[model samples]
Target: MGIAEEQSKASAALASSKTTSSSRDSASTAPAQRQAGKIDVLIQGVALFSDGYNIQIIGYMNTVLAKLYPKQMTTQVKTRLSNSILIGDIFGMLLFGLCIDRFGRRVGIILTTLFLVFGIILATASHGATVEGMFWMMVTGRGVAGVGAGGEYTVCTSQALECADSTPEMRRRRGMLVAVSTNAAIISGFVGSSIVSLIVIAAYGGKPSDGIWRICFGIGIILPLAIFFFRMRLNDSEQYRKHAIHSKMPYWLAIKFYWRPLLGCCSAWFLYDFVVYPFNLLAPTLVSGFSKDQSMISSIGWSALVNFFALPGSFIGALLMDRIGRRQTYALGWSIVCDFGFAIGGSMIQLKNIFPLFVVLYALFQTFLSVGPGDCNFLVSSESFPTPLRGHFLGFAAAIGKVGAAIGTTTLSEALASFDNPTKGQQAIFLIGSAISVVGTLCVWFLIPDAPVNLEDEDVRFRNYLEANGYDTKEMGLSASNT
Candidate 1:
């Protein structure tokens, strides 16, 4: 069948399934019961706040740590410290994703939370007799925390999307809910880090204080631990439960069936991170580099200010996805917003009199990214596969994306160092980032297919596809309702 014909069939199937599901929905529960489901969705969405907060805290630490331990903040040391969490994330995404697929989402999330708590405690208490010991300790702690935060991507995102799909009211708003949940967490991270920074600076009389960094790391423990209590109370989504009860696709078979989406999601995420992490993690340094007169506090405050603009951009992108479709949103954000921003911003970075212009362009670049591929990537990864493989696919894609983040974080310093002038080096990195964004745009356009998927109908379609392909549906416990 032609691509258009296939899409038309899928849409019709989804519409019919939605109608049927709506009829059954009124009979399935009382009004209070429905209201409770909405509450659950909200809780799950908020669960991501910890992940977002932790990720950005590290970025904020770049400036704070540089001042607190200037001796150990060498380029190599800084790179190691910056990438520790990301290194952990690389493994965590893979491990937690597999755990969710095999053991269940609840189990995976609980374990992830425990790791997060342990990592936070280790990082908060990090100290040693020598600078080496202290640096490694912090790196180790952040790496551990990164593992938990990494797992959150697979566990939390999959759960939020699944929960949204389980409810009719939420299903239509899944794009916004997922995007807002993740982006809100990011915004919270930016806000939380800024508040903590101001408080620490004030208490210490604006001096470089180790206690400030420790306190900031320690504060990350609160939200995750609190959410753990609620997550334990929550149950797996109806879609996952149904899939788990009826059938489990073999790992190899899932790979065989969904390789196209795996490639699309993985590449898209990889490219997004490749461009995003370098700028994001280096935001403080970038701002500081642009204007030598800017203080540490000013640099951090500027970084936070840039992130504030990202909040609306994220919501706008999600809303556009619902209205114009994911492909268009992704393409527009990449080509128009991110690509142009990076190219123009890089070219202008060396302009001595127009430093503020560079900052504005940089902020606009980030804002456009959040609107386009940032949150949309998560939505695409989760929705691209059926329930049985959703976690696995999303996890794998996320893990690979982390690799991109790691590369971006690691190489950015090297890129900056290669040039004599810091501003010129930053210009080089930004131009390179723009080139990478262009490649990412092409990947989204050609590789990622646009399919309007309804979760219930998708499950049925997968079941039938398996059966028609000579797989034993009966053995897998496929039921009429599931089809």
Candidate 2:
């Protein structure tokens, strides 16, 4: 045969071999791919559970710690203690977000888990002869844990959303999966905290014990530790893997490209936290204001009961998110339901004669929050940006939201202190949160885009943009199969 004919034959053989090899790889990987979706959701849920559990556990510890160290538990000290974890959270969100963007999801998660474990251990083991020493140690530990939790917020949300986006069936139900996991975490936190509180009460006969708070903090570590190995085995999302070869856009460039979506996610989260965290932190106080006859346990129990309302709200919101759209669901929750609930509840809260009305209204307010922004915030944030910058944007948004949370908590505390009438002060805080929610609603309406996005399409678009901008996009293919 001529030289050209021999070359053609060699090319044909090479193509046939490549096709056969691809088939073999696919066959071997099929089972693992089938299992990946479930595993990803499970891991994400566990991480979120740890996050919620830690937050509530610390909240529950506040009163106990105050009673144990009354002299050192001044308003300033309490504020500092509360701010410690939040400050750490701010750092964690930014740090892990960058790490995930650079290193990949699995690494970011493992690192976050380790930080959480370390922080929990430190906080649990904290002890000192001086109140100052003990306080700072605990604060530092909590701060460290906050870092991990903050990272978890970004990494886990991004991972879960990316995984969901890869599976068509899962993608349609993404809102439900993300919201349910998050709401479940919140419920788990409350349940865990309540159980610990009951245990402390039982062990100490309604008195404080040195080990009570320690056990609570220690228990917070169990779930995270149990899942650490699994997290280590977790794979980066296929969407990310397909795009990982492309050089990342500069931070400023990524911002410029995604600023509108970022604004939507950040502003919505800020508003949600601005309303939710304060109400949550002050729940017992709010309940007490309405029903002065309730015991501490009764008050705690009522607070937990109120959280149940959020469960159904989340499911409803998830359904709405899938059926209607993320933007509408968010606006409905924030502007229509939550805004009205706060406005109406705040107005009625001052009317001491209609205490039951106030309680019912307050529960409704929480329920609205649960169904709307509460369940949808993570989903919107994670889905708004492309995979390469998703973590950074989500982390940044979460950090901003935490800022809102810190402000809300501080302002509410001050308002409660400054106003001679506690009821009026709490009512004022509610109005402020409602007003903020209104602004959030406006932001969502105008700033957030309502469109279905395919992750693979996004990656292709991003790669095309990169290629147009003179970046080498030849290294990675345009499509990645779900795994």
Candidate 3:
């Protein structure tokens, strides 16, 4: 045979061999077993990394900065530090999203570890250096850690959402993976807050409490290292690899296709952070306003105990989100947030007398807040796009949310500082936050698509197009056009 014919024959033989091998491998595994194992691992990994940072970082940001920059750490300064972290988050999100699909979740995670290490070292080093210099270093450290968090949030979630088998039973199971991270976050928040309270109480007994924040920061470094080492055992997801090879697009085309869902996701996130970021960042100052005495410090301890109540609410929210759908669950959560804000506003108006009432109301707010926004945002954002764009979509969504978070801190700070009475101004901020949350809840309901729970139900408009074009249901596994 001539060379051209020989090459053609050889190519055909290789294709046949690969098909046979693929078929054999598919035949060997029980579908149920394979789906269960992969989805579970995905959920666990996502949960591990998310909770690992949020619990420590979110709980301590206010207190940590307050200790280091007591004189200069106004709400605006605190917000700027937060903004710096967000700047890093934006870069990491784009970088990780661009590469995660192309390279794989495992590789992206390994890269994230480097950012985490750098962040931790810089942040910790701030403590060792002069106080003024430490302020900038602390911001630098948070920025690096944020880059790692940016990678972790998008890549890990996309890996879980995309890799699950396209079956109803498997999809519900897979949804749990997305919830795991937030669940960890809620749990960690409770733990971190408790630690803060314990340190405060110890100070009431004359022990030095100034150093406690440093311990939290030091401990924060350990979680990422542990996650990095654990993730080293995980493999690159098969579905992502398969999709990368089969449907790869020019980068521009992918962005064009995904812009709408991406925008919707990011907008939802922006609203979420508007309340949560500032609330957490300025919590220490807010608490201090009530009292600086031993009794007042004990109130914070009581508040920490109350925060634990949010954990269960989050667990239930995650379960119902998968059942009732993302839109409804999110809208419901925000509605509660708005009402909670009103309650908070009322308590702030009477801060001296209704301290117990404020703590109780705040606890309830924390519960639903922990469960609803965090989990729903991840679920909706991760599922909003096709596998190719999932990482980019989620990364950008998170970056926007961080921006909102940064603004929230500054706005709250300015509001607190400028007010004739800082306490009443806080009440006004709550009222405004309540209105914003309601608007966000409305946006999700009116504008966004009904996110499909499984891969088979996706590309819904495209599915309709296929049916209209005379595609057969059995051959394509697509619904025929009712039209």
Candidate 4:
């Protein structure tokens, strides 16, 4: 055969292979549609709780660590902590994605929990080391723990969304799991900060402290234990079976083909974290500017007490998401975030009395920004990709998000140093974050396209994407949506 004929034959073979796979997938999904049932809320709740717990641990680690070694900890050192954790987080994200695909969610969760336990204990023990050695050891432990956090968010979101019945009504129910994770995250920050404060006060008698942070580190092991036991009853989503039979594509190829959706998802997540990390960490550092002692107490107080309000904020955000649609919900949340940036700036300028009004406005702004974007970001992430690639996509977004987080933490330190007052620096960071949130919202509104709200739609989109690219998908007839 001539070169053109050979090329044509190769193309035909690839097309035939794709069609055959599509038909088989369609056949496999029929059973899933026939037996649509609600996923157990208790199981998903445990997964979400664990996910929130890990984020809490990470969210507070740098602040708590800096407190422990006040004389030795510089802005540069703190930035390293942030960057190191992100590095570890990326590895964990990738590892979780691969494990979930190959070994299933239960196995993946179980394996990662083991890592969390080990990492936390090791980090806590680092407190005993000399300052120079301890910093590096603590960084290592956090990195490992971050990996566990990455897994929890990525795998749990995918698993929760997958197990829901795929009917339209059921799809809405599944989407609530995203809210569960977000609600838990906001609450955990409150809880973790409180826990850290109580431990510090009791151990150190309200003085400049270090040892109490070790207790904070050790406490990280508890949720993973609880989650592992609870997740024992959980099972893999029905969609995986369809993918196995229909796509006939190796899991890796399926993921590679869906990279576009993954890119959009990751970009959104990166921007979300860029704003969130600086905002969250600002509480402790900004407060520290007033007095070292007051800073710790104030951060602890806000984290514990203020977080009570975040649950309601998240619920409201979720309700709006269900009502207003994902794009509008995200746009509204980001707009609020942007508005708060100006509020923060104005409040800072009015600091003649260091007004109670400024403090109250800042806290409230943190609340809306915390709950709203968090709710929208996780929800969009959960729904953006199909079950087969969901975990990988989540992981990819998480890995990239960590980079944004590092930028947040690192820039926060610089902003603080450049301005004489830490509070002023914080106002600057908030202003910048607010601007980013606005841009992020616009990106979602104009550029980020919508996806199928049900499994049938998801299947059609997947099949269509392949077919348009000259791949046949006649074999996998499966397109059942898990309601």
Candidate 5:
């Protein structure tokens, strides 16, 4: 061969050898990397399980508070008590959402646990100069806890999504893992709250006593601390490491590209939570209206059982997410809920006469709640955007959803107080929720865009989109330590 041709062939051969060696290195690490991703997601999800348990258990605790401090647990006090974390959700979601995007997932995740620990410890040890003062102290403590809980929605889901994107095998099931695995924990939290309250109340011989209230609040501290340690062991997700913005983001440029999907995500979450949280908060109340002879404890057990039905629904949603995609699956779930809700709400009078049947139908309605919006909100919020902006959009959507939860809870409480018959009030909740679901369905069709499941894929599109709009993509990426 000629001298020039010989030099070119030698250079190409050396480059190919280096590429093969790199592939070998990546192949060797892939399994461990995948396993670490699973561990990371599991740890984050456990905190959510605790969150579900901690937050929902309060409904049962509220019953105890009313009995123990008749003069203290006023309607207004109860409202604040129920909404404390929900109100906290707004601030937590907003602040932590921004922080996670700006700082890093590790920083946001670790800091959040401290808030939870403080909130839980302060709440469990709630004390003041007087009984009335103590109750407000409890409210403040829970509000703090709510902030932690609110932040969890943003950080946990974002972290979990990135973790699921760690490998192709994992990425294919990302919908099921991110949506069902973590969300099921939240739903299970609802179940755990009900069941644990039932067990604790049973320990107290079917009573909502001082001890019952304290124990329930105390149990919330465990997971936050456990996960705090787990979180310390974690590095930022590889995806976050790869594409996270190292400098100030161009907000105007981001909006130019993402605004449409952002609107859909925020609106869907708001409507879904508005429809769902009220029914969840008032489960015992609804059960009591139907089962006139049951005691408060019996109603709590039934609520647990009712919430259990959502677990299956969440799994079904996960499957649907993969098969049909996010927008379609969410729409189908909402449509089913709307139909069943209208039927159940309209038939309340007749169904009350057949209470067992009513319970089944009520649970079935709750099932679809998880199947559709419960699954969709987190998946859509976390997935539609790239890693750098995932926290922002997810947090914004969650914060808006919490506002809906707060308003829905308050409005339903008003409906219950306004109506002469309690059944009428529940009927109103079902019907109104169904109508809201219809609006939610429309948002999905018109606004919500379908997104790729893989983090790398979405990041590419986002980077390219930004470049098209005169923004730089080179400034984003991991440092050598991050890689």
Candidate 6:
């Protein structure tokens, strides 16, 4: 049943559960109570920017690391290097996911950012007497950093969503706000790493050195360091203040009420990342394939340019989010990308030769990838559930997406190796990605629901659901602002 219908059904009992001392009306959806300040936007932006930069920057440095430590960086080692952060992310998501729901967003974001700073410092300084030892140290550091970045995925998203949900206007635009604020921030981080890597390499006169990779890993620390301080000044989102379950949580009751959405959000995220991470992490490698003799600088530059196209796609998705709804925007972007993937992969031979035209086509393909799935992933995942357990569910969904990314990333060399010709392997990727996008489109179409008619609609409905099932709604949402 819809939230509105459920809210209406529970209206009679609302007075019994009203807050004891707070002036804000529990039943009202008024704008005067919440302003959604610039700090909200700032926190979301930097948190995501730091996250994107730290996670994707490692992929940008693979070639440089391979050059510096070829003996130690074998195929198996390469896979471990790429997947370590992803593995770390799953752990962080689960741990902090539950932590934030139990404690508060303020606690989660602070700890996660500290993890980012500590991980980067350890990674940037990674060294040992033996070359293999150094590589091992770097991998260990990145895995820890990945944990912090992974935790940010849920904390930033839910915080930003709540911040934007204070008014009718903001609630309608909540999808856009969360997408633009957090999801789009990731593209910035990802693209920034590509550009920064090229710059760092050029500074060393196009040669690989210990300093180059160290500088690349070390530079990411600044953003998170700043994020840690800013997060401390913040209070938990008002929604969290009202609906958070501080005492013993009704886990089985929540499962009974939310299992369908949990399944849908988790699976949708997995499918999106399965397509997104491979295409994303492999963009430079794929573009480099188009030119037999292009310098490393040129390939990376082109990849940066192609990834830059994601900005426009993010803006487009933000515009469509409230206008058309999250489900429609997500399915629409994937559908178009599905066509592009087939066309580009099927015609790889001819397009690869034309060079400039191929970049444009591939760029347009990446742009749309940003538009739908890119934009909607964070926003949709957050909106799919209620506030009390948003951190838990959202973190779980994101962690699942990382799993898809790890699988997809590992598929890269393995998939390519299975083919005889380079063009055939590349073609296989496009066709596979296209087929996956088709499945992704259908998954969102049926499984995910549209967003709320009001910001607290789900929270209110959740209260009714719990109270009817013998859970205490008032004992929950203990104030965190004071403690």
* Candidate that scores best on TM-score: 6
Task: Compute each candidate's TM-score over C-alphas.
Answer: 0.89, 0.87, 0.80, 0.82, 0.90, 0.92
Candidate 2 per-residue C-alpha lDDT over 1-483 given as tens digits, one digit per residue, 9 for 90 to 100:
443353344334543444543443455432343335756775687778778778766655666776688888876677677777777889999999888977788788788988999999999999888988888899999999999999998888887777777678887777777766665556556556666766775677666677888888898899888887877776777667656543445565456456777888888888888778767766766666666576556666666666556657777887788888888888888766645656664675456677666666677777888777887788888777667777878899999988888887778777776777777776777777777777877888888876445665555545444444466544442232332
The lDDT values for all models are: 0.74, 0.72, 0.62, 0.63, 0.80, 0.81
Give the poorly placed runs of model 1, Cα more than 4 Å off.
Answer: 1-36, 245-248, 475-483
Clashing pairs in 1: none
Question: In candidate 4, what are the lDDT values of residues 288-334, reduced to their tens digit?
Answer: 45455565555666544544455566766767766767767667767
Clashing residue pairs in all predictions, respectively, total 0, 0, 2, 27, 1, 0
Q: How does candidate 5 fare on TM-score?
A: 0.90
Candidate scoring better on lDDT of 1 and 3: 1
Deviation from native of the Cα of residue 172 in model 2, angstroms: 2.2
Q: Order the candidates by TM-score, highest first.
A: 6, 5, 1, 2, 4, 3
Of 2 and 6, which scores higher on TM-score? 6
- Candidate 6 yields a Cα-based lDDT of 0.81
User: Which 10-residue window in model 4 sums to the lowest lDDT?
Assistant: 474-483
What C-alpha RMSD separates each model from the true structure? 4.0, 8.2, 9.3, 6.0, 7.6, 3.4
lDDT of 1 by residue, 1-483 (tens): 443454455445554555544544444432232222555655655656766667767777768788877777898888887788888988889998888866678898788988888998998898889988988898999899989888988888888778777767788887777777665555566667766776776677766678878888888898887778887776666666445523355665566666777898899899888778777778788777767777667787887777666667887887887778888888888886656556664575455457776667777888888777886788889888887677778989999998998898777778988889886787778788888888888888887767445676766555445544566544332122244
Q: Which scores greater on lDDT, model 2 or model 6? A: 6
Measure candidate 1: CA RMSD: 4.0
Error of 1 at 327 (Å): 1.3
2 against 3, candidate with superior TM-score: 2
Angstrom error of the Cα, residue 427, model 2: value is 1.3
RMSD in angstroms, candidate 4? 6.0
